[model samples]
Target: MSDDPNRIKALGGGSLLIAWQLKDKNVLIVGGGEVASQRVESILTADAHITVLAPASGLHPRTKLFIELRGDRVTHRDRQFEGPSELDGMDMILTALDDNELSNAIVKMSRERRIPVNAADIPDLCDFYFGAQIRDGPLQIMISTNGNGPRMASIIKKRLQAGLSGLEGQAITKVGLLRNKLKQRAPGVGGLLGRERMKWMSQLCNQWEMEDFSSLDDSAMENVLDKGWERGKRVPKPSELGISRRSTTSKSFSTTSLLLPSIAFFTGAVTATLLLSYSGRR
Candidate 1:
């Protein structure tokens, strides 16, 4: 295990990103403020049927799909939301209420009902954390800090926005091109090799400094895949792809090498002390 404290702490944290398929699924949003407006767009990205519960009805353009329920009185009975029992079958729930107590209560209820929930700005009450996401054709880039600091996540996402502008469509097209070529080269074995190659190319593409993604050439991509495959076969997980066992062993040896000099100095000091004591006694 790595000695990084953030990595350990973030293990228990919610997913930094999610690819949800909410098409034809019911989704409920508790508040109709700007936050709710933003969440509505995200859910609608999956083509979900959404319902909003708020006192008055005013909506952003993106929230047009959802049906709105109005009223100030708490009409909920039987511990069930009165507006729609349809919401009970919803695969996901999002709450953006100003009332902390109400948000907390709804989050607790959602958990008991086994529905995934996201309470805006409240990581402790949420089952998932939504990150800054940018959609480019078939590729989706998600940047997150596990809710430790959303601002930092957003900043990184913006930086990525400029870096990854036209890369996604290009990458997907390249993958398709690569796969088709592989079908002729190795047939059944092509898919496995194609996937490994695709992964390497994607990583290299992401590291590009400029919006000009002309650097994703086939030869270079293949070299990375070949190296990655050799390295990957010896590792247990994909995250450890670039890490080398030899480098780690070398660092450990260096640490041990430093201690030898200290040990020799300490031994010399002790011997000198012993000689001085014997001469004084004589």
Candidate 2:
């Protein structure tokens, strides 16, 4: 393990930071204790198809309740994890067992199968961590300290949540509706390209003052969106709107005005559409 707090190199020495969409994906979880319950709760919102391999009698009450509430979304094998065979078709594996030997064994098995695995409280054996997350409807902010300082991540997430307004969520919803409407009404508009759309959306979010959606009723919001789209159609270059193309193309855009409304609305809608497309897979 490296001494650097921001980096966690797993057993096979691979390091990468990524967000996996587990919707309708097969996930195998070992153990039924408190830690496992916590992992389950964290991923429940992801809509993953989960199967737990643990002794039925040893399952935690909370875990049982979660399975019951979710109905068919989750299933239990009612037996202890045997070996790598349980991971044959799994997209990912998670272990929350106190037994280090068993967890290590599972990690080894997962590695041989090229499956990503997360071992609770065992950063050295984990491929990823369930970092703190702040979700406001279609808006989501994830805070990660690599595999260290989870408590600090939670604290920062809370602080961010405190500074965020509920109207931001409503703004995201409104923007999403407007984007969909625009796509339907003007499918061939050049302003709808990735970079152009981002530039225009960012400008619109700033111009409309997305901090409060209550200020604009449905009609007013539509009118604003119409005007923004008109501006987008007219502005051949981002400089025309006082925005640089580099700003729109950067990996992380500036959050000076409305705080990620443009990027969040675009990415969130794509994610939602993908989830809906995969919903029927399982």
Candidate 3:
């Protein structure tokens, strides 16, 4: 292998992050241990129909709890994984058996059936590895070391979650709603206009600092839509944006708030902006 970063990594040596919309998809798990329990929790997020093929006595307490709680979607077969017949109709397979022979048999059958499979602690044999994840409702961050450092990935995941706001999940939900409203109001089209519209929306998002969401500058947001938006690609300043907090009682003390052109200044900061634009054009 050449010493280029662009070099294609060998199989099981690379990671491409994606979310599976496994709602109603059949997922067969062949184990009763802790690793199997983890896989059960991970796939449940996608609302998959899960079947655990293990004797009831062997099941991890958590795995049994999951089946009990989500009896509508999750099932415990209380039987050993049979032949290739077990792989039939299964969309995805996750096996955490202590028996290497059984795990390998399932891997081969899964391959022959063209099913994606992941064997516990067996990176080279897995079609995918479950990374350490942080979920903020619709926003999910998965940290992976390409199956090399699960422990490190978990540490990083915890650190990131600690730094993030508790309201981040709710904020994402609000932003998604806002996005939907914008799509309806502006109605994006194709070609140059479409690209420009997309850029404008992106700039709109960029204009909102983290503090903006916490103590949202409602008037400034309106002014950006009303005044600043006509200009393409230029992210407007706080002074130019006419910042005002939605709350009167509590507000974030920030440099941008200090810089906001006051009502005695430029609440209609557009006037100053228009003058600037006119002068520059001349």
Candidate 4:
């Protein structure tokens, strides 16, 4: 909380604004190099339809969308950025171009059109900042120093990536199993009821270790749900889920607390049994 007016708030430092859920939405990227590719890969997990604007668009085999390679500076190619009309109607915009002017122009245009933009290396012109991430299956770990220190974010991300090595996918799968059990038990709780059930299920997941997946079974799920029901009437808020979406989208799980230990377990030293198994194979 500096009054210098030059500091952008880092992620997880008291108050932070984060947005998720860009699935099936249009995401425009104004560059096609490695930096831009990193941003594209980050959003691809959310199922966003990406449109890349570059002089020479490279192949993104995993991207199920269009890539237009204009000449230098985004000339005219198959479905190139025609104009604001092309840039308009996008859910989000990211600029990783080498030219500061182009990036600034894109940011300004996006702002005029009420679109959010994340400009690499330019925080003043950006509406948001991308963080370092660790992914295991559907589980995602995001660490941001806001725009304060990109190096710090990268360091933390690398540490987490090492610590949460294998457990990312396992933790997500375990939670899914628990959530499904809750959903089945309370099929009629559409709005508040269904969400509360999910909330309690998350609590259960937090209370138990990932290795003890048995603790997240049907009986445990029901017990957690019943306890929540006993608490009386309540409406859930967006902050509860860390990142909330519209009704059409599933609520994002707040893995901030849950992902740490799981990452450590997955990436840390293996257990004696695991070591024995590896030795035997060797």
In order, the Cα lDDT scores of the candidates are 0.62, 0.73, 0.75, 0.63
Query: Using alpha carbons, what is the TM-score of model 2?
Result: 0.70
Clash count list over all predictions: 0, 0, 0, 2
Candidate 2 per-residue C-alpha lDDT over 59-137 given as tens digits, one digit per residue, 9 for 90 to 100: 9999999888886788888998876688977998999998899999999999998999998888888878777887777
Better of 3 and 4 by lDDT: 3
Q: Please name the candidate that would achieve the greatest lDDT relative to the true structure.
A: 3
Candidate 4 to truth, TM: 0.59
Q: Write the per-residue lDDT of candidate 3 for residues 1-282, one digit (tens) a residue.
A: 577655545445457788877999999999978988898999898889999999998999999899999898898899888788887789999999899888888898899888999989777788887888888788788998875688899889878876775556655665565455446556766787667667776775676644344433344345555565545446566556555434221243344476664653775777889989999999
Per-residue alpha-carbon lDDT of model 4 for 1-282, expressed as tens digits? 566544654433542646588877888887666777677677767777777776554524322232333122222223334567767678898888778987887787898889888888887887777787777776677787756787898988877665542644765676687567656766775698777776666665565445344224456444444544345523223233232222211112345457777977776656766888999999
Runs in model 4 deviating more than 4 A are 1-17, 57-82, 162-165, 190-207, 214-282
Q: Give candidate 2's error at residue 210 in angstroms.
A: 2.2
TM-score of each: 0.53, 0.70, 0.72, 0.59
Total clashes in model 2, counting residue pairs 3 or more apart in sequence or in different chains? 0
Which residue pairs in candidate 2 have backbone atoms (N, alpha carbon, C) closer than 3 angstroms, thus clashing? none
Return whichever of 1 and 2 wins on lDDT. 2
- Which candidate's TM-score is highest? 3
Residue-level lDDT of model 1, residues 162-222, one tens digit each, is 6543545665766555445434443455376667655654564455322223234676444
- Candidate 1 TM-score, C-alpha based: 0.53
